[model samples]
Target: MPESNTTLAIRVQGLEQKVPTLDGELQILQGVDLDVKSGESIAVTGPSGAGKSTLLSLLAGLDMASSGEIWLAGEPLHQMDEEQRANLRGRKVGFIFQSFMLVESLTALENVMLPMELAGAEDARTQAENMLQRVGLSHRLDHFPNQLSGGEQQRVAIARAFVTRPDILFADEPTGNLDQANSARVEDLLFQLNQEHHTTLVLVTHDLKLAERCVTRVQMVSGRLEAL
Candidate 1:
């Protein structure tokens, strides 16, 4: 087992991912090593098919790497089973997806409350309301995802991700679906919350401007990472 680092939010060493394809083995990531300190922001930038999303999934415990050691928020992700990883994620991780993956059947407030509710939090509703208000979504609390516009839905997603105040926040193309104005607004909101919460942010984005906003930046190329 790899030794845990209290000052590190994420540590990846000798990471590799391989999938057996019909043609042959597909290597999506190779020998990836990274260390993100607590409360730091990093952007993973890469072109399509460069294993950017795969790395994010592995680091976030959504999937296991073929070979690697991953320590997330002081927990050994590589050594954990699915259930253990899921529990760890529940306690320390939050995610915002490019598509604004909200529950259509639930209202904005309900969506934001889901994580805390799942964790058996007694004040989930109140915390969710407060987070929504912080994201400027107090007026849209009762609105469903389908009823909201793209920007509004993303705001709801942001509120949901931050409602639990996870130690690490993983955002994949957070503003990919928004217009210029909305993108700027969301960018500001993301950084603001990151600062206030002192959360470690790992973002995967194609937008160079967004990447530049991060304190640290790295680019993925042909399954390898390079400093930018």
Candidate 2:
């Protein structure tokens, strides 16, 4: 499919996130501004506690910002409550976590079918099968998460994330737990799927090599974001 008419997939202005501490509030992200065009790939890289993950979370509407405006596919995320944010996320966004957050009890097919089924897609099972096959996990469809290797579990996670054909994909440290070979495989699949589906990608990672693959790289330092 081609990219959407919207030129910008994400737009953030003066974004800030703060958490309460014993003394006062600690700021994680401060005055962050960003714009990601449709079908563009972005990598957010920074050191520990630099708020790279926090920024990604806010952009994906997984967390509320303390202050500022965030527009996701032209939808005003900062003005929405949790329920509205959840609805928006479910309809237009896909997320892949570093932990390979697959349901332990569900088989690979069932896991991948989850989002499609939730969206009331009648062909969820067939699409799930095809997606699993795309990730080279066709034979593992019946396998449980515990029965598969770490790499296989990650593949399942990737399949689940991309099955919905979301408008934007958010990935946080997607290859953090994988070995070199598996990391390469996952990276390839991530880019391949993004290009094929014309999904805007926002990835958070510490690996410079991985970050370099993105069309744009933004670095976070002490709660501020800057282009590198």
- For TM-score, the strongest prediction is 1
Over 45-74, each residue of candidate 2 has an lDDT whose tens digit, in order, gives: 999999988898899998999999998988
Worst-scoring 10-residue span by lDDT in model 2? 1-10
Kindly provide the TM-score of model 1 when superposed on the true structure, using C-alpha atoms.
0.98
lDDT of 1 at 31: 99
Q: Residues 95-214, candidate 1, lDDT per residue (tens digit)? A: 999999999999999999999999999999999999999989899989999899999999999998888889999999999999999999899989999999999999999999999999
lDDT of each: 0.95, 0.94
List the RMSD of every prediction in angstroms: 1.1, 2.7
- Kindly report which residue pairs in candidate 2 clash with one another: none
lDDT of 1 at 75: 84
TM-score of 2: 0.97
